[model samples]
Target: MIFEMTTQVRVSNFDEGRKWYETLLNKKPDFIPHEGFVEFELIPGCWLQIAEGKPTEGNGPLRLGVSNIESERERLIKELKIDKFEINSRPEVPVKWGTFKDPWGNHLGFFEYLDKDEEKKSIKNNLERTFN
Candidate 1:
């Protein structure tokens, strides 16, 4: 059974990619296995790798969960200088989400649950898994 996972995105320039990712993540990479490659442990077992190479076209909108989508979107727009994107939701959907891209065109986004209790439960479950 699969217990852990990693997703990779490529960039044309290594240094610029590294700095952009660091700003987006708001932390230094958890691991830099070699030159031109770095990884961030987004959750306990989920990894996001950024590498130096040609970026894949139309690859992904690797969405991440957040506590507040609006604030997070604002932060990204202001800090990363990404084009403003709209957050969307439906009555049948439990979360609201928005998507944006990095300088190298790697798709990324944030989402937030409408139910605060569910959000708390998810956070608690993740914390338990992390500490256990």
Candidate 2:
């Protein structure tokens, strides 16, 4: 059975890619496997890999969950100089989302659940299952 997972995004320049990912993630990478590769542990077992290479088209829109979509979007815009991407949702949708790309064209995005209580429950459950 699958227990852990990783998703990769590529960039043509190593130093620029590393710095861009650091700004986006708001932390230094958890691991640097070699000169041109790095890994961030997004959750307990989920990893995001950034590598030096030609970026592939249609590689992602690797969406991450956030606490507040609007605030996060604003923060990204001001801090990362990201374009003001539209936040989207539907009447029945439980979460709102927005997507943007890095300088190298690796698609990335963020989402926020409308129900904070449910989001907390999901986090607690996932942590328990992953750790216990």
Candidate 3:
């Protein structure tokens, strides 16, 4: 099964939002269907899009959990020519995640997950000891 999703952002201006998104995604809009709508298809199945409209009050607090965040961030800053993308947090928190916002005011983050293989090994070892 595939795990990909698209999130749309609302903004008053389309072109302004497009520029901001380009800076954040480090690429030109690849999924533009019209003048008012622009999309940055980050990967094969994932999408981040924006257009002319206002998201309802308390609409969402959407976040995209990106991997290898440091590398991806370096590429984005260099290739996108953004002035600066502030680092929202350090690695002190429980989530161990850092966040940044796009030009259109959409929040994004780099999330690290535990290694599954290590977890499986530990679980198996504990089960063996208990069962034996």
Candidate 4:
């Protein structure tokens, strides 16, 4: 059974890539099993890997969930010096989101739920399922 998940985003330089991710994630990686690869355990069994190498074209906008999209976007701009990106929202949609590129052009984004109760419920359910 597929019980876990891992996603990779490549970078041309290990040092710069790792630093960028550190700033974005707001912490050091959980695992550095080798010289050029680093892993962050984003959730219980969910992993985000940053490996040093050439980046793939059209790879991803690896969106992460946050509590406040605008605040997070501002943090990214102030901390990482990212360009101001637009946050999109719609009445039919339950969340707001925005995307930005890392130094190596790896697409990354943050999304925030409009409904805090639903977001809390989803997080609790996901944690329970992942851990139990």
lDDT by residue (12-106, candidate 4, tens digit) is 99998999899899989999999999999998899999999999887789999999889889898999999999999999999998988998888
Give the per-residue lDDT of model 2 (tens digit) for 1-132. 889999999999999889988988899999997999999999999999999999999877999999988988888898889899999999899999999999888899999988999999989999998988
lDDT value for model 1: 0.91
Worst 10 residues of 1 by lDDT: 71-80
Q: State the lDDT of candidate 3 residue by residue for 50-76, as single tens digits.
A: 878864454445654454556666766
lDDT for each residue of candidate 1 in 1-132, tens digit (9 for 90 to 100): 677899999999999899988988889999998999999999899999999999999988999999988888888888888889999999999999998889888888988999999999999998897787
Candidate 3 regions with alpha-carbon error over 4 angstroms = 1-4, 67-95, 100-105, 113-132
- Selected candidate, larger lDDT, 1 vs 4: 4
Alpha-carbon deviation at 19 in model 4, angstroms: 0.8
Q: CA lDDT of each candidate?
A: 0.91, 0.91, 0.62, 0.92
Clashing pairs in 3: none
Question: Local error of candidate 1 at 106, Å?
Answer: 1.3
lDDT of prediction 2: 0.91
Q: Determine the C-alpha RMSD for candidate 1 after optimal superposition of all C-alphas.
A: 1.0
The per-residue C-alpha lDDT of model 3 at residue 93 equals 42
Residue 111's C-alpha lDDT in candidate 4?
A: 91
Predict model 4's lDDT versus the native: 0.92
Off by over 4 Å in 1: none
